[model samples]
Target: MAKHYIDTQSLGRGPQRLAGQARVADLSRLVSDLPAQGDLVVDWSVAGRADSAGRNFVLVQAQGSVVLQCQRCMKPFEWPLDISNEVEVVATEAELELDDDDVEGPDRIFCEGRLDALGLVEDELILSVPYVPRHEVCPGNQPDAAPEDEPPAKRESPFAVLGSLKKP
Candidate 1:
């Protein structure tokens, strides 16, 4: 079982509360290939909870600061991430129905084996990131005209965004 696994025994005893700190550089999957891992850190908490209907669930909350390359400026900018989600627990993977056209219920996760904590938080962090990260306004981009002495900087093609997807 994973070291951070949340087993049924813990849930049976009562609600389980967990919290920790993880450096952004340590979570390879969370910030893959982003420059300047630096001292960025994420504070995360996971709690076993039950809804009003008594259905078992896990409430995952995470707060972190990340650096993302601006799609417009191609420069790095800080983005704050505060994610909280309640995922319903199911007995088996078969209960997860993605094709249901009816009113969708809360997110569902299987309760078999081990429910990895760090992995779950990382997943939520990834989803919290903007599809296309950009700064409100690029640095030095003002209403005033550019100085003539400084040569025009080369601009990256729009496809530059796809560079992150290429195999290293």
Candidate 2:
């Protein structure tokens, strides 16, 4: 499907809702961080709302699965993406700065009239990705497994050598 851009101010005023499916390939920011192979599926929904303080906010929900290279085994693994967030829309950087100290509240986003729904989805997906992706149990051979031809190494303790030198 073609990309969609919404007027942030109008959407916030009406508190509109948007839902769609976007190919993972189309999300450049998300695709760059993932492994080259495999198909990914992304489903997303966004809604506009006004808080009690009359601040414009955007609610986003994005779910999908992408193949990631496991850091442990260096192999591809399927990782699910589920992101749900509500961001207060601010007109200027100063507004965001004012809200920065309010860490306990929802995040704040600065919108310059137009908001890119696809880019928002991509950002959410990227945030959902783990710092290090790995399976609970590796799908292939254990990474630390020793070669079959190599015998396990044995070491003599320093204390044993000292004891031998001080034999009674």
Candidate 3:
């Protein structure tokens, strides 16, 4: 499918809304971080409006699910994605910098007329992913756990071996 691009300037002139679905496979950057197997679904929407202060802002909402490797079990698990963000559109870098100190304000983005909607969705989705993903309770036995029947192998300490080799 052909990609869509938005004119930030036009969005600023009036309120606008957009919604779409993007296959996880199509988002290369986001897909790279996910596991090879399983299907991923991404649904997203955006609403643009001019605030009372005359600042242009876009409200982004996205939901999806992808198979991610569990850090604890070293197995694949389905991870759900849900994200919502309000981004202020700024005309220049200076404007973005000025808003940096406003800790409570919405996030800012610089636009040069056009913006890629798919890229925005992908970025937000990536940010929503957890730093370390794992199931609440592992699905099966822990990988490092020793089997119930056999005793763990015993090995002498390297230091003890070295001491024995040294002259008395």
Candidate 4:
């Protein structure tokens, strides 16, 4: 059976609630706070998988919508995030190794005691953010004006030339 811990010590080997799925709105206090302080509402209806190696790995599968602003249109919209991630929870880099997919790697989050699902979710969402997030199209977007340096030139096509040659 899996065991839950509130400290860095590793408990007996078994299945636990390491990975979770939840619907959250604000993550300001969750991620910024070091010990990962926030409430992560796990949806028991949605099944998730969690694997650990000496308290180093925690994989979570989450699916929910996050409200974000469209970088192009400057309008807020809800973007659904289908979360399937493996986050490593560890203390030092020396103890990290790439043994399993969910094994917390060298560049992983380290916790003192309790697992902060809220902070983990926030990090995942931020990483998933697109560099250029925009809707299909917005009304505010307009065609760019031609540069002043470039001069316009008129050219007649073959069809136009043939029409000109025709009498009438």
Candidate 5:
């Protein structure tokens, strides 16, 4: 069985915290089965809040880092993540819409009044990746450009000059 990421749903009503480690890969999968390599130590703390509908929610502050491929270079790199996010998991869409007291953004999603913090952790980590991947220093230097206006000139080979010399 794969190791389950520590869940922190119980903390919505009060200060809650969870700490665990998972692999850097398997990030795309909803339930990541992290490899035995480096594990990302995730630490999350939530101070509960109430939405517009008076439904209780949690304000999550997560800090962690994962190894991800650079969008530009396809090379493996470490991406650090420290986010102050507020996710209001309400009972229904109407409740979320009617609630006007808190700031609503696309990050908000309606669930069955249950917060799956592990899922949220996976998503936020993925969102942190840059669209373009690039290496710090790409291999191979740029080719030297010849002067465009210069006419073609015949160049003598060093071997040809050596061949013309007669040995005594």
Candidate 6:
């Protein structure tokens, strides 16, 4: 369905890997988090493999940075992106439903023929975004001035002691 779609069955039979880098703007949902395009770039990959138990899984990974306005200070800050997820692939909806209750197990998805490669990557990226965008510490934390009632803390110059010693 997508340009990057791949068949899960093929992936399970033989290990296959796909990777690429794309501008943040290319991700429809995640791009909305950016204040500006800036240098935001996403590197992503999808790989398929089978465990010793013969269970088929798709591994997805993506990393990037997004520029966002701080909910606290209203200043733009960079949010680092790191996403890594693995999901089991099932051929039928019944299998997906049966696997759904196993919360501890890897997520499961159904595949008729192929999986949407780009769509999967985009979903993972979107989940990485914070519900409320904010910086750990706002970059614009510097206050403009001292409060009206308080005087600025006076600083004693390091040379003051030397100057006193030099007094004749």
User: Per-candidate TM vs. native?
Assistant: 0.75, 0.78, 0.79, 0.51, 0.54, 0.75
Model 6 scores worst on lDDT over the 10 consecutive residues at: 1-10
Question: Count of backbone clashes for each model?
Answer: 0, 0, 0, 3, 9, 0
Query: Model 5 segments beyond 4 Å from truth?
Result: 1-19, 25-37, 51-53, 96-107, 135-168
41-109, model 4: which lDDT tens digit per residue? 433121122344355555655566555567787776655566667655666655454454753443466
How well is each residue in 1-168 modelled by candidate 6, as lDDT tens digits?
226866777765788777888788767677764677676788889988877777778899998887778889888777888999998888888888884567799988788777887788888888888889887766657558878999889999988898778857
Clashing pairs in 1: none
User: Which parts of model 2 are misplaced by more than 4 Å?
Assistant: 141-168
In model 4, residue pairs whose N, Cα or C atoms come closer than 3 Å (at least 3 residues apart or on different chains), thus clashing, are: 2-15, 7-113, 88-104
Taken over the whole model, the C-alpha lDDT of each candidate is 0.79, 0.80, 0.81, 0.52, 0.55, 0.80
Give me the runs in candidate 4 sitting further than 4 Å from their true place: 1-8, 18-23, 29-55, 96-107, 139-168
Residues 1-168 of candidate 2: C-alpha lDDT, one tens digit per residue? 576676777753577788898878777777786777356678999888766677888888998888889888898888888889988888898888884677799888889787887787778888888988898888765568779999987888868877868857
Q: Model 1: runs farther than 4 Å from truth?
A: 9-12, 51-54, 102-104, 145-168
Displacement of the residue 93 alpha carbon in candidate 3, Å: 0.6
Candidate 3 local Cα displacement, residue 24, angstroms: 1.2
| Ten-residue stretch with the least lDDT total in model 3 | 33-42
C-alpha positional error of residue 43 in candidate 6 after TM-score superposition, expressed in Å: 0.9
- Model 1 TM-score (2 dp): 0.75
Across residues 1-168, which tens digit of lDDT does each residue of candidate 1 receive?
124756633465578777898888787886886767789999998888655655678888999899889889799988998999988777667777754564556788777645778888888898888989988878977567779998888999999989999998
